[model samples]
Target: MSVHRVYLPDLGHGDFEPGAVLEITGQEARHAVRVKRLMPGDVLEILNGQGLRAVAVLGESRKHPAGHGKTEWAVDVRIESVAQEPPISPRLHVLACAPKLTRVEDMVDQLSQVGAAAWFPLVTRHTLTPPKAERVDKLERVAAEAAKQCGRAWTMEIGSPVPLADALSRTHRAIRPSARLVIADPRGAPYSPDGSTDLALLIGPEAGFTDDEVDAACRAGAMLCSIGPHLMRVGTAAVVASGLILNAEQPR
Candidate 1:
């Protein structure tokens, strides 16, 4: 059976020894107790949202009063073992202009599943919608859930919405200096996965980027690359490009 995984934001907060007991509360507790129906002695896995993972066994379940006039369930688990997972190599960072909140959420989820190191939501001239802080929270939640589903210990970082110019200037920090900065454009070099470790992909809005924006990114040391001849939506382009890069990076 597939080991059920739960995200514990505080998993690495305290020192853990063998047989150490840890308490899990709130929605995560509900998922473990009510949804999974986990009982004492049930083996499960826990992630710290970093790279720390632990093998834990459920110890007990309890009902407690929540602040908002409701009862909530909490669970206790005993840590059996812990391990640190190494980060993905040649980190992949995707810089995608916001399409819409809903679409952006899906993009974040997909990228997280594909082991993207980070995601940047760019507000470009052709962007139809502006991303908000609330949506950033939603996107993070989606990424966390995707990480759990995909059996990844680390979650992708979602950056706050920023203008295209700001996003271009900050690209250097997102990846290594030697990493490739690929801007998705039709009139550019054809993409060929070179198994490079550091790659930052910049996906434009559905309406496409303006000439000045393209020139600015190129000046910032971005290489315009084409994913395909056909036009693709922002999310679709991200998924396809990320998949290709990841596939090429895989060990042969």
Candidate 2:
């Protein structure tokens, strides 16, 4: 099994110092101590999941380093060091229809694995999945779990599920002019791939965008684009678009 990268907010104080005892509690402790069966001297990396990481050592109990036949585990972890990484480049944000339950969860997981800056759930005309307010927490958990599995230094940010029209209006107001917007149409014209520094990719449901939806997106400055000859699943299309966006952004 791989050494899990656990994300805990209070890994250390203001200036992260190496070798400071980090206290792990709740689910994290259960995972590392009970489930993981991690013994003293085992090493794991601790991430605040906001771009900071530290190496930590496991210890058994408050009175650690016990000899003889006693085995109560404690996270007597000392952060080796905290190295902050640069933020994700050319932020690739995704806007997609809210798919069904299992599908949406999988999409969120896949989106995090593909390094999207944020996932915005969209409700379109043909969107069959009713946006569940309570599911936001479920989505967040999926994102965090997926990020952990993928070694991402940041938890995937999930925006509230909004109507497609409202989402477009908000996008126009929220993003800068240079932020390229691309809509996946399967029938759209090919766009120049060079203008993707901070991109927003919009994907419709399996039913594709309605005529009105297309027109609205166009009015809102979204360029129509295609992902080549084959039709792809909503989740697959999002991944492909994110990859294309990441590749198109110019190297700084």
Candidate 3:
């Protein structure tokens, strides 16, 4: 059976050397013990979200009393080994106009699974429904869950909504300096990997970008590229464009 994985945001704060014992508490511990029925000696992996992963074997578990005779579960796992994975290359940062309703959640989930470094909602002239703070928080949770399911050591980041102009300007350079910017447009040139290690891909909304938006992007050194000939929804275009950029090889 595939070893179950759990997230530990503080994994780096503690020593994860072989033979060390670490306590996993709260929901994570409860899920492993109660839901998974993982007993002593069961194996699992713990990821720190920042590339540290530790293989561990389950140890003793205990329950701490909450008020009113309620109890919370905690599990101890002994570290077997630890490994750090390097970040994926040609890191793709997707900035797409939010799709209507809950479709944005599905977009975030798929982007996480496909190894997009991060995602930001693009606030464009044609954007109908921009994500709110609560939605952003929920998307972060979704990204965390996707990391565990996909066995990714690093979880994809969820960024706040960014306006098209700000996203294309040097003011945002600190976010991903030297990153090549690409805007997905139906009338653009064919997409190709340009040997850039970092990329920021912009996907427009259902109504599409204004003519001025596309023109400004071009003037700001952004390339207009098309993933396919057919029209795609905001979410679908984000995933398809991200996949093409991430999986393609750089010119030799």
If scored against the real structure, what TM-score would every candidate get?
A: 0.88, 0.85, 0.94
lDDT of 1 by residue, 31-145 (tens): 8888888789999988878898889999989999987889999888898998888888758888888767578888888999888889987678887766778777888899999
* Window of ten residues with lowest summed lDDT in model 3: 168-177
Clashing pairs in 3: none
In each prediction, how many residue pairs overlap at the backbone (N, C-alpha, C within less than 3 A)?
Answer: 1, 3, 0
> Candidate 2 lDDT, tens digit per residue, 128-151?
775577888888889888877887
Model 1: lDDT to the true structure: 0.82
Which candidate leads in TM-score? 3
Please give, for residues 1-252, the per-residue lDDT of candidate 3 as tens digits.
778998998658357988999888899999999999998999999998999888999999999887798999988999999998888887888989888888999999999998899998888898876888988889999999999999998999988878888888856642476889999998889887768998999999999999999999999898899889799998899999888888884334
Better of 1 and 2 by TM-score: 1
**Weakest lDDT window of 10 consecutive positions for candidate 2:** 167-176
After superposition, the stretches of candidate 2 with alpha carbons farther than 4 Å from their true spots are 10-15, 62-73, 170-177, 189-192, 250-252
Would you list the rank order by lDDT, best first? 3, 1, 2
